[model samples]
Each structure stands twice: as structure tokens, then as C-alpha cells.
Target: MASNRIRKSALPGFRFSIGFTILYLSLIVLIPLAGLVVKTAGLTFPQFWETVTSQRVLASYRVSLLTALFAALVNVVFGLVVAWVLVRYRFPGKKIIDGLVDIPFALPTAVAGIALTSIYAPNGWIGRLLDPLGIKVSYTPLGITVALIFIGVPFVVRTVQPVLQELEAEMEESAALLGAYRWRTFRKVLLPELVPPLITGFALAFARGIGEYGSVVFISGNMPLKTEITPLLIITKLEQYEYSQATAIALVLLIISFALLLLINTLQRWTNRRLRSA
Candidate 1:
């Protein structure tokens, strides 16, 4: 005979919750994206293509993508090191250093831009020291990468820190006892666990660097085809009241960013599945 009792769902009201979630996401995310697409649709294909492919606009894309990529890569390396240091050792001012990592998140981006510009300007303190070597940090592409790196560092450190914390030191010791070198222990043991979170951090930092505006604006010096970023180009178009052109450029950025993020997420998922199987 069939059991008399009915099986209850582990999550009661899951249907209602899922419906609300979809509705919320639609209102907040889908609607805005739809509006962006609709606004761009006002342009003919030729107009849209021309707006996004202009020499100045194309230059901005290159500068933005290249600097953002460099910054994110730098952050991934340095951030991981910082996270490891914080988790694996205690030093004087450790707490202070940890607190400092979040400064970019709390500080106003405009303020960050101004402060970075001041410090890196040719006449400024550090700038004066570096000027003799002919390395210019302010008013150049290097400055833009520096600004992006400053803002992106926290993403990597924060993402990796918790994961590093969860990993026990005994694992490394066990590996050492088994005749593994430090590099071998890290590669054979710790790295697999860290890969997912590192990718997450890289994605976050890369995305932020791509879309960054305020902190980069002042430091970039807004020179067309050199240090100018895509966000700044968007603002310039808006100020000129070229709404259709602005939307077209924005749509291109959106599409590219979405594609890159989708690829990264796919990689993350594959890595996770492999790790689980291992």
C-alpha cells in the first residue's frame, strides 16, 4: 500500500519566493537593460556602428580594456599575496594593514582621483622623485592603470582572504611530512582550493576597472585617444546631448562586458566541477 503521509517540500513557499525573486530581478535588472537596448534601437545600424567605432571611441576602448586588464592581473597577484600574509602570519600593525585594504571601498572615488593625481603629479612628492627617471604616472595611461589597480586591489584581497582562512595550516604540514617542498605543497594542495575564489576576485576587479569613472577621471587627464576611458567618452556624448550615440556606445560596452563575464563564470563552474571530482 502507498504511504498515507504526504511528503512536504524542504522549502515551503519556494514557488512564491522564486516568483518574487524573478519579479524583483525583472524590475531592477531586466527593465533597465531593456531600456538601454530600446534607446539604442532608435539608431540605425550604420549610426550605431559609426558611434561605437569612431577613432576616438575606439582608442578609449583600447585604453580602458588594456589598463583594466593590466590592473586586474596585478591585483590578482598582489592581492593573493596580501591575503596569504594576513592569514598565514601575524605582524606588527596587522590589524591596521587589514583595515587599510578597505579604504577604496569607503573613500569617495572623486576624492581618490584627486588624491592620486596630487601624489603622482610631476610637482608632487613621489612624482618629483620619479620625474628624474622620466616615468610619468599622472596625465597618462600608466596613471589610469594605477588608479584602476588602487580600486581593484580590495576585491582580490577580500575574495581570497576568507578562503585562505578556511584552509588549515596542518594541510601544508602534512604535505611537508610527506616529503613535499613548499612550492609542491602549494601547487599540489592549496592552489586547487584557491583557484575558484581567485577567479571570482579577478572577475570582480576586472569588471569594476572596466566601468570605473570617478577615480580614473582626474588621474587619466581625459586626453582623447591616449588616457581617456570609455566611461568618460560616454559622459562627453551625454553632455553634448547625443543620446542615441551615447546609448550605442554603452550597448557595445554592455555586450562586451557581459560576454567576458559569462566566459569567466563558465570557467569557474568547470574548475569547480573538476575540483569536486578530484
Candidate 2:
């Protein structure tokens, strides 16, 4: 009876489907990553170390990691606020504002760079006002942060927005009945439900910011050891035909990114488990 059930429930051509899935993954993901590893492996340990640890490369790493972290953190705060506002309230031009949230997803990175450059240049409208106060936005590290924030904001907003929309108001009402303050209620009730999505968004934004190029290039001024980013450094290596060096740096970034993402996933799981137990 068990054998008969198994035979009857089997998908037609399951073997072929499974084989194609494996082949497709190999062709699309594994093969390219393998090629990258192979190329990076061509370098000796000292060479790889030197390539990834050059003063310029180290500086780029600092800039990239810090700016990305800053951007992600900024997104976590403001994205939550934006998502909350959108989900809980009605306001003027609400539909237009909702549509605007997706602009980053549709806009080209290079175009974003150009547009930001134009708006934030010293002579530009906003820049002109800030320039007198001794603030520089374009062609600086701050500009890089702004560009990253621009592109990364959507990830956090979109991730948290749906979760916020699905959340019932009854929880807030219950907390209020229990004499909880507004902040306490949100912190205890809403935040736990939002934490998983928030972390996921932060990770996505952080990862994307690490590799961001076009949106940063125009604003960063590409000043090595100053405003340069790791992705730009990688591109420079490739342009100089230092293929092995580029691959080595890329490999290092890949490893670090993977480890960080894994750590985030572990933390998320732990948080979920604790929440469930509570």
C-alpha cells in the first residue's frame, strides 16, 4: 500500500526535472563562482595578501564597510518610520508617495549618481544653501554615504511595509489597556514582529552597498585612500589588467559578505526562537 501510494504520487519525469534544476544552478551560480575562485587561486598567498591589503585597498574597505553600515542603520530607522506612516495614516498625495517609494528600484544607479551629483554639488540648490554653512555633499565620503542611503532606503521600506500592513491594531489596544506608554507598546509589541524583516532589509542594503559602483562613483570623486570604495578599487584593478589581484580582492569580499550574512541569519533565528518562547 505504501509503495502503491508512492508510485501514484510521483511527479511525471521527476528525475529529468531534478537533473535540470541541478544543471541550471551549476550553470548560473556555481560555475561563475568557481571561475572566480580559480582565478583568485592563481595568486600565491603573499601576492593575495598584498593585493587585498594594499594601503589603498585597506582604505577602500574601511570606507565601504563604514558607509554601508551607516546607510543600513539610517535606513532601519527612517524606513520603519516611513513604513509606519504609510500603513497607519492617510495623507495628501498618499498614492504618489507610495509610488515614489519604488523609484530607487526602477532608477538606474548611474542616473541616480548623476542626479545626486547635480542636486548636491556646491552650486546646486540644496548645496548652495549648505555650502555657506561649511558643509560639502558632493565629491566626498559624505556623498558616498548619501548615494548609498539613496539606493538602500527602498530595501528597508519595502521589507518592513508589508509586515506593518499585516500587523493587527488589537495588539496596540491591548498594550494601551495594560497601561503601557506609546513607546513601550511599540517597543514590546510592534518591534518584535518587525525585527526579522528589519534585519533582512538591513542585510540586503548592506550587501548591495558593499558592491555598489555607479551610484557612488560620480559622488565619491574616486579619490584613492580617501573617498574610494572597494568596488571602485576592484574595477580599477580590472581596468589595469590585474586580473588575479582583482579576483583575490573579490574573493575576500565574497567570503566576508557570506560570513556576515550567515551571522545575521543565525541571529535572526535566535531572535525568532526567543520570541516564540516568550
Q: Please, what is the TM-score per model?
A: 0.86, 0.90
After best superposition, candidate 1 residue 44: deviation in angstroms?
2.2
> Tens-digit lDDT track for model 2 on 43-160?
8899989989999999999999999999999999999999889888999998898889889889999999999998899999888999999999898888999999999988899878
Locate the minimum summed-lDDT window of 10 residues in model 2: 269-278
lDDT values for all models: 0.91, 0.89
Poorest 10 consecutive residues by lDDT, candidate 1: 1-10
Judged by whole-model lDDT over C-alpha atoms, candidate 1 comes out at 0.91
Candidate 1: give the clashing pairs: none
Candidate 2, residue 31: the lDDT equals 100
Please give, for residues 76-190, the per-residue lDDT of candidate 1 as tens digits.
Answer: 9999999999988989999999999999999999999999999999999889999999999999999999999999989999988977877778888999999999999999999
Clashing residue pairs for model 2:
none
Candidate that scores best on lDDT: 1
Question: How close is each model in CA RMSD to the real structure?
Answer: 3.4, 2.7
